[model samples]
Target: MAKSASSVDWLNRVFGDSKYSDLTIECGESTWHVHRVVICAQSPFFDKACSNGFKETSSKLIKLEDDDPTIVREMLRYLYTGDYLEQTKEGEEGSRRSALSTNVHIHTIADKYDIPALGDVAISKFSARAAREWKTEAFAGAIEEMYTSANENKEPMHKAAVAIAAENAKTLLNDDCGQAFRKIAEAVPKFAAELSIEIVNMKEKMPPTFARYRCPNSMRCNKVNMLEGLGQASGSRTCTYCSNQYYVNVWVSKKLDD
Candidate 1:
């Protein structure tokens, strides 16, 4: 524990002070003064950037392009602390949405920089935040960005976003944030199809207590009266909507009584 505390203190000092920093990393108009050793120890991209043959080695300056400065700052923080700090707002909902958006951006940056551990950390945070903030517009944007930028199968964020979207299909497809669903459909047709199928399957597979039984003609059926008459027996019920027959099998769990 003493060694761990000492290491934390060392990292804090290194991140907090620019006194011994030998390198300057510029992103857009923003400049960050940092230690080359600290960055190189954590990232192979920096390892090569600070090597003898690189221009950064001679000038001790590296300029990054096409990267958000906010995300870059968090990336540096993760490099030093092994965790990225989330900035929260006044409202709980707003803060959570902001954190989710930031984590998605950080994950993208981490992947771009080949920092797998940092990417994993960012995605873990993103997944947790997403579970709470999935209904927000920020989550929609994050999902759009994740599908458009990140590797679809390799990134956990993509799958988590899809799962949340699937579970909340009614809200996501019909609400004000329906544009996100449309964007996903346009950007990734295969994923959109899969989500649609999952949503249909979910509605169909729901228990009688929670689900509205639908007839072949898309009309709601009185499942309770139908089930009461055919207790413990498998039979076909005629749909009142279309007069089509469908089979119904009831399976009650013994644990339901407990």
Candidate 2:
């Protein structure tokens, strides 16, 4: 463990050192001096771009016109340290939401570069950040961007964003963030359909309660006894209005006699 730690420290130092950097990555108007070996080790796209006979092989410069420089920096950090930097402050909700947005951007950059592992790391961080701030308008907007930018070949981030949106549909569809939800539905029909299906599935899987159940046909069933005698298990019921079947799981505890 100590050796591993020392190795990580050495790699971090090397990553920051400019003395041995052999390649330069230009993003937008900004430039980053980086090691070709380090980047190629993590990304096949870079490996090919930096290989012999390629234009970048002689010039030792690669231009990423579409990627943000800050995201590229984070990608380099992850390549060297095996971990990406987390900029969100603890106990600060706004900063945390911003961090989630940044993670999604980083994921996009990783996907663009064909670095699947880096994309996976970014998605993991994004998921953690979303768990903390999924109801925020910032997060909803980030999901919109993610779904919009995602292509057919790369869609894990889109799927993850849809899952987050579906899980928080009630809060996200409220007055404050309703427009963002509408935009997502309009821009990405497949994602919208998946979210709707997930919402219905979630409602069907909700635990049984005495409160009246709302049917898909816009009618309410006030059958309180439908769940009264059911024990701690899953069961199905048919809505009287739509005649559609729904499933519910109930957990009831029984007193133990000593």
Candidate 3:
């Protein structure tokens, strides 16, 4: 069911005003005055923590000293609103990379707190940011974080990363801009293997006309190798503009010419 605007506003006010708040969630020096019904209903960990026999049941407080305060705040926000805005730290406040990192952290922490829906939301946000910023250094950092984080629900995030990397292989594997990407390929064997498989799968579905190759003489060479154009079956072709020879593959319907 869709939530009414008034209800969302009321909930936001509850979170903001702390009206009749029954539970206090403390992370580092920060605290969220929340309610048991609102928070516990969505998080199994919090539900268990606030159940009878737990000290928090009587104390009405849960301390999360180990979690990042910014992440915790976003988590609380999601519990109330069913969504969260990116909350990057000072230096990174507006950058897409920072937003990507925030989503990655939220995914892992959502898993930690047994909030599967929140984990899914985090991955969705992570993927959107990743698609836009895959060429940036932030992508490599996010990949490392995704692999290193102790989260069990990683397959969706893994597929998203590998897909982005596979689709942009020329820039991600051959260009100097991809140095960090190459380093990540070396550091994470699992990611490297998954990316290789995705690349192979992508190639199997691609048509011959989609193949592209750079002319040896110039960086500005037209990369398109559409069969309908001057492109032909594999052999040496001299660049008309640069007079340099380069190899092109037909990839289908023709044999390699000597």
Candidate 4:
């Protein structure tokens, strides 16, 4: 009878670390959990994202507090049972050490748990410090590493590299990247010159369009019209009557030039 009861208990424990914990996560896709927290949702971290997606909601968390039973219990709840991590701010902790420890430990655990949003925030925070001191190589290497770990969103990686290139390229014009830009510019000098000129003038100079608007008689008629009819005898253009000419539509160029 005891063996049968034991067999029933084993059947009742359907496997997996099924823990009942409630928490709120603040990063990545922004999700709220009630009874159960599913794993492997979208993440904000894998990309070169600025915001790290993580925090604790069961009162404030202690820094590096993963060692604390309160923090560690929650961390394990997520790790073992595939639950979402808590997201809390700094002021929520009772002490500086606890708060800092909670963040450090929880964030480390988040990276291990594959919570990209939290990881991204951690990296971005760290990378910002590195980038401020002209750390191009470090930033570049970081971007390369981030690219592989990123999910569907690829904008962050491009943005990071482009931002670095834009700033670095200005003073780095003598470098390889600058040399490459120069080569591309050299390949299309006429195009570059055309782009450099006045926009309207360039349009007027096209093959099928009239380049100039000239007057036939500058002495007698103050008004001028040349494009009405040029070749045939009947192809004459009428002139506009200014304040001096009155309402008369004078046939200014009825005569063909030999």
Candidate 5:
């Protein structure tokens, strides 16, 4: 169920307000005043950090020096509001990270913090943004980040990039926009292998236009012929080489382009 407007307004009000805040999250030069009940409940990492025996338990502050400040801000926004805005402030777009890159980084941060829901949201947004910006430098950068930062086997972002490349193989692999993608593929062997596998799977699923059959009489009349439109039917065929009547079973399992 969706939060009521009043509840959303209350959460938004609490997000930045220092009133009743029990924790201070510091990332880069920025700091967020947040409630422990909200932040710690949503994030297992925060919960552990704020529990007994940790310095944060007494200091009431968690410093994320290694994380990007912008991505951290977005993650906090999602924790407070249940969603995040993708667009940066006007004019800041030129200096800030691309929306696609932001989503990829957000997914990584969410995964690190053990917030599966936030990770899911970030990956879904990454997929949609990738579909729209697959031809741009931003997409290439996101692909590089995803391939390098995402360590899981066949990660969702990896699958998303491969799917987009498979759908637009011609333009992405042959056109000018493909140069960066090609470079990334060259640098990253696992990405290239996954892309190759996805392309092969797509090809295998295509409807074949032709079939090849060799005569069953291998001893004397082993004849081969390319047949089309047979549509999985059996028929009597005459062997032109040996003049023998034989039943031919046809299965159109070969693609013409192959």
Candidate 6:
């Protein structure tokens, strides 16, 4: 038999020696427990703007489904107190889970839970660390922050996050998401050119087979306009209804777009 990540005595405990201290919340929804709780609400502005037939997501309490749900709990733990570093350590197992790395993971969970205050703390704390940590678990959280801002980023918090993402790109550059990375890099032109160079180098090292990406979105795939004089089988593709060029990549050999 193998021991799951859970099942360990410490798995049931909080990141540190923190307890299920009594807590209260009042807003859209209120949910708290011995270990953790969740609170969320739909944006009223969105609802009112297109009110022809809009409804709000009712407030509801949510709990962890994972047996060893330390990741989420720890983030919530930080949300309760801006001082994750100062949280009192727990018994025998306390030594096992003490590290700046754990705090980084908690930051990710906090971002997932829409806890901005906790996320700011995570970013501020992790910003000073070296590159190794950013490329690992921290990368995902940074990307999440970018995506969140893309939708609607307006505040001092977003400004700080944008700053960190740009600064870290020089060390954290990866080719897989070059487009997204470029967008983030442009935000901080202080070293944009150098950062872009690193991104290009990493992209160049990737295998050619990785070039073609499957379109995963639900939108319908259609002909792309093969650029003029490009000489693709799609015959310099053009479409009046949807696009100006045929999806050149999808066109058959020997024929031009359109």
How should the candidates be ordered by lDDT, best one leading? 5, 3, 2, 1, 6, 4
lDDT of 2 by residue, 1-258 (tens): 112677678778887577888998887776778898778977889999998689999999999887666677778888877777656466733344467778777777777778778778878888877777776666767776676665333477766777777877887677665676666677778778878888888878887545333443334543323233334546666665556665644212221122
Clashes per candidate, residues 3 or more apart or on different chains: 0, 0, 0, 26, 0, 14
- Model 4 misplacement above 4 A: 1-123, 148-150, 172-258
Write down the worst ten-residue block by lDDT for model 1.
Answer: 249-258
- Lowest-scoring 10 consecutive residues by lDDT in candidate 4? 42-51
- Model 5 TM-score is 0.79
Which pairs of residues clash in candidate 3, taking residues 3 or more apart in a chain or in different chains?
none
Please report the TM-score between candidate 1 and the true structure: 0.68
Top candidate when judged by lDDT against the true structure: 5
Per-prediction TM-score, please?
0.68, 0.71, 0.78, 0.25, 0.79, 0.30
**True lDDT of residue 9, candidate 1:** 70
Q: Can you rank all candidates by TM-score, best first? A: 5, 3, 2, 1, 6, 4
TM-score attained by model 3: 0.78
lDDT (tens digit, per residue) of candidate 6 on 52-71: 44322232223334312444
Give the lDDT of residue 169 in candidate 2.
Answer: 81
Q: Which ten residues in a row have the lowest lDDT in candidate 3?
A: 249-258
Off by over 4 Å in 5: 1-4, 90-95, 150-154, 209-258
RMSD of each: 8.5, 9.7, 7.8, 18.7, 5.6, 20.2
Model 4 residue 92 CA deviation in Å: 30
lDDT per model vs. reference? 0.70, 0.70, 0.78, 0.37, 0.79, 0.41
Q: Scored by Cα lDDT, where does model 6 land? A: 0.41
Candidate closest to the true structure, highest TM-score: 5
lDDT minimum window of 10 residues, candidate 6: 209-218
